[model samples]
Target: MKAGYLGPKATFTDIAVQNAFPDAERIGYTTIPDCFKAVINNEVDMAVVPFENALEGSVHLTTDYLFHETNPPIRAEIIVPIQQHLMVHPMQYNKWNEVERILSHPHALAQCHKFLHNQFRGVTLEQLTSTAAAAKYVSEHPESNIAAIANELAAEKYNLKIVKENIHDYDFNHTRFIVLAHSHTEILPSLTSTYEKTTIMVTLPSDRAGALHQVLSAFAWRRINLSKIESRPLKTGLGHYFFMIDINQSIEDQLVKNAIEEIESLGCHVKILGSYFSYHTQK
Candidate 1:
């Protein structure tokens, strides 16, 4: 099988794809949207893209595309620990004082904000498309003054020297990646793991009182454990929106099915985005 990921190689997404689909052929795309398009267009059997980061919240590009552009079912989820590093070209001097500017993806820069401010006070910081892309740029430029914040894999992949390791301000940083496929038929049932999670998009009935509460009440009465509940705009107009709720068990459970039925009876719409297992990698 073939899988797509955002990369030139060595980005967190690339690492997650490698960890989750070790035996599959990996295809790298330049951007997150490209990965999604690759899956939607059948350019690849599936795609792994960032959904949320523990430190940085959601990846707007991925979230927005999932909401507006396509409806490909998420086959599984992967959470990988993120360890950002400071790297420079091998020929470049290996000293922090010699670095003139720092390069990385915006999210990586943000994750290491405090460290950058304290360690390299006034260095120029630039954002690239991905962490691995930044590392690739630093490798090709061969300049002595620029450094990139990426990962160990990137440093090795690009043959860059690590000036500093674990540069992220927080030690428990992680990013949640969602595995998406063209449809349910493309999902490999044999590969399903445990820690099941069911994600559903719910649109509340308009002009109703306590509608949102009623939706939650369905799960509450059924004693279902909700792992996450978040809201997003419906894009039709102001004040119109939908909620994405994640339950702690698979949709095959009778309790979960009944809760959805009760929610729909409340004049709301519910769409099961995916009922797949989640994989958590060691930090």
Candidate 2:
């Protein structure tokens, strides 16, 4: 299937998509919102969008797009381990001392926060839209004082130099991504019932003290454990909102079906996009 991800190319989001949807035709878009919009417009089969990062907290724009805007639901979730490397033009800067300004996507730079502070010291930091974009800029700028923090794939893509290796402070850093599709065809061929988590979105009839409790109690009463829950405002209405939740039980289970039916019976909207574990949702 045709899959789209955030990029100009070689960004962490693009790398996540590539790792998650290995065999699919991988296409890169410039922004996360554009990737989501492509799915809404049916420009691609499913678009990979990063929802949150271990270091940067959340992709609020992505959350907003998925919740506030009228669009297809998130069919699946993918979690990609984040690893970053520093790349530069060797012809211009042969050594770390040759660089004074480092560039990267804001999140990437943030993940490698300690690394940058200790190594670069007082060097200037330039924030770009994506790591690939930063590499692209470094490729065109030809400045001995410039370097970029990006994936090794980006270094190969741009033929940039690698002055450092695995500079991210934590090796366990991971970014969670979600796949957007036209409703029916969200999961890939390898994705089956073996998945450990199912992500879904719901909208309540009205906001009240026990409004959330009643819906959550449906799952709790059924003995289905929830892993995550988040809410974002509705675009058309000032106070109206929607929610995204993760439950341990897959949607294929009878209990999940029953809970969903009960949730809808409460005059709310229930949308199950897809069911899959974190690892396979990439791309």
Write down the TM-score of every candidate. Answer: 0.92, 0.84
Task: Give a tens-digit lDDT track for model 2, residues 1-283.
Answer: 8888898877776776676666888888888888988777777899888888887877888876655567776676777777788888867655666588899988998889998889788888999988889998888877556999988888998988888889999987888887778768746635432457777789888777688889999999789999889877776678777888888877889999899999999988877755655554322
Tens-digit per-residue lDDT, 161-260, candidate 1:
9988898999888999999986654555233465999998888988488999999998998899998888877888888888888899989999999999
Candidate 2 regions off by >4 Å?
186-196, 203-207, 233-242, 264-273, 280-283
Q: Candidate 1, which segments miss by more than 4 Å at Cα?
A: 184-192, 207-209, 236-239
* Number of backbone clashes in candidate 2: 4
- Return the clash pairs for model 1, or none: none
lDDT (C-alpha, whole model) for all candidates: 0.86, 0.80
TM-score, cand. 1 vs. native? 0.92
